[model samples]
Target: MTAKILRTRLDCVDYQEACDRIQNWAIQRNSCYVIAANVHVIMTAYWRKSYQQILNRAALVTPDGMPLVWGIRLLQNAQQTRVYGPDLMLAWCDRAAQSNLSIYLYGTTETTLVSLTRHLQQRFPSLRIAGSYAPPFRALTPVEEMADRDRIHASGASVVFVALGCPKQEEWMARQQGNLQAVMIGVGAAFGFHSGEVSQAPRWMMRFGLEWLYRLITEPQRLWKRYLINNPAFVVLFGLQLVRGLIKGQ
Candidate 1:
């Protein structure tokens, strides 16, 4: 089942369950997308009907942020936990290696892709990386878009990990839904985290739902508004949602 977070329908699956579901999709060669729902994701969807439709139609919308995990616990599931994007990517990579699934990486810079692919191959020695591409930051021309689709299709990848971040990644996956023949997962900053370009929060901080603070401190300039504005807003808005749910006996 999915838990309602504002306007988004977030899948109420734990880490293992999410992994199993993705594995099944890969095996079936399904063209589907997964979004890792965070506070920013929910808030973005709250304001954007187009993005909200994307989230609503996703194959799985895992709670990638601590706040969303707590939101699910409060609203629907009592034992909800975070299915973090970076960690989930790693888990999928591990399972893909064992299952002999060839994977492709999309988005991020060439440098990060090099480092990420190297580290992933190091971590999962038997993993097959079918291909990797770092699209230009600007919107792709039709020719370029077709090239990307052709490259991925020709690579024979069963799973494609997208690290374009936010609505861009989600939107890109949505665009490729029918055109691509692989399970597309919008992994946001997993490329940076896996490539060693960005450090992740410690296990203790993550366990305590303070990873956002760590990220805010690490990249204050880039993330200040997202954490500062969105965090408080989500608290207030979601609090109201909780109160409404309670009054209705949900």
Candidate 2:
């Protein structure tokens, strides 16, 4: 186990560690959710106690963004790397191929799912993609939600990668816990990035914590508020938490 940054419940774990834990969850058929904690997610939880409880209850919360990596290092006195959600999805797919773990993909457009499945199976030839589905972009009726759950259960998937984005994906995973006997990971935009439907930031930018800037530039209309508002708010709030911790000498 890795030391956690208590402010955001950011686990100070690297990619390999996260993959190992996911593989363990698959073997155990555990019903739990993995959150990829980024600045936006941290800020969202900060502003909403309900959302914070969701984060608190997550089985694993990887430091997905570089700022979170930095936060863990600064606060925990331990170095940590970003376990990026998109890359983690790929890593798990590669491991799943060798381990014989079947997976399901939920959320995103049908076209994106098609492309993602194609690319994944091409890369990990032995990977078992049990099924994929793109739900309608609206709240599902109870019957529809149950049908979706049954579809996943019937597919015999050991892991489900959800791409519904942020709080919605987290909430959905929370609701499915225990009811869904598989690892439910909220992977945000992994579907788009993996399928090449959306370009990812370059390695240099990602390493330097500039991935958010790249994303903001790429999809300004959709991401402007998230980056512009959440980023600064996280910095300020986390700084306060740090100061308070120091005053208390934790």
Candidate 3:
């Protein structure tokens, strides 16, 4: 099921169900994209129509943050749990190993990719990583883009884990549908976190929805506006939505 939180569709899927769906898609070689929607991602989509369309058309838009999980529970289903990107990537890796599915890694720095690949192999010994590429940080030229696509296509990967981060990653995946014959998942910062290049919030903080606070404290310069501005705006907008729902129910 899905719920509209601040006008963005969030799938009310638990971790296991999400992994199963992605695995099935990979096995079938379907061209699709999965989005791990957090508060920042949701708020961005709420304000940007183009981005919202990208998310709405996604094969799966998992509630990746506690706020989204809570929002889905309040608005739609009470059983919704977070299908976080980093954790989801790990789960998929384990499943891929067990099933002998091949995966390709895209985005992030080459150094981080090397570390992440090592970590994944160390954790999931049987996992077949078809290939990996770290594109230039700037926008890719049309020819460059085609080359990248060809590279991925020729690699014969069933699943491509894209770590380009939120809006950009989402947009890239949307453009690749039909053009890319594999499941493309926009996993945002999973590469960095998994590679140990970046720190993650404690499990306690994540469970209590304080992961944002931890991120803000750690990367204040980059994340302050996102958390401070977008978060409060989301609360106000979602609160209004709840009020309207209540009024209609009454």
Candidate 4:
């Protein structure tokens, strides 16, 4: 089931169930997209009606942040744990290796893709990576987009891990829903984290919901506004929702 947190719907799923659902879809070659919803993702959806619809229409939107997990617990299910994107990608890779499901990599720079492919192969020795592509940073023309689609289709991959970051990746996946012929997952920065190009927050920090703080400290110029602005707003807005729910009950 899904719970609405600040008007954004997130799936109440643990890692195992999320992996199972993706695995099944991959095996069936389903053309769908999965979103790993974190604070930035949820806040983006909350502000943008069009983006929110894209998220609502997704095949799955896993709670990728601790706050979202807690939000789910308060709003609907008490036992919901986070299904983080990078970890989910690793888990699915392990499953795909065992099941012989080929996967394609999309987004990120060519260097990162090379490192990510190497790291994945080393971690999951039997994994089959059908192909990898790092498109130019700018928007693609219609012809260019179609060519890229053709390349992925020709690879015959059962799943495509997209690392193009939040709204862009989500929008890309939405556009390809009926055309991709594979499960496209918008994994944000999994490629960088997995490729060792980016450092992840320590486990303790993640457990305590301080990962955003760690990130803000690490990349202040790039992330300060996102964390500082969105975090407090989420708390205030969600607190109002909780209070309203309490009033309704009374």
In model 4, where is the ten-residue run with the lowest total lDDT? 6-15
lDDT of 3 by residue, 168-212 (tens): 899999989999999999899899999999999999999999999
- Please give the lDDT score for candidate 2: 0.89
Q: What TM-score against the true fold does each predicted structure earn?
A: 0.97, 0.96, 0.98, 0.98
lDDT tens readout by residue for model 1, 39-155: 999998987899999998899999998888888887879988889998899999988999999999999999999999999999999999999999999888988988999999999
Q: What lDDT is reached at residue 67 by model 1?
A: 85
| Best of the candidates, lDDT | 4
- How many angstroms is residue 217 displaced in model 3 relative to the true structure, after the best TM-score fit? 0.9
Clashing pairs in 2: none
lDDT of all predictions: 0.92, 0.89, 0.92, 0.92
Flag clash pairs in model 3.
none
Clashing residue pairs for model 4: none
Error of 4 at 173 (Å): 0.3
Work out candidate 2's RMSD over C-alphas.
1.4
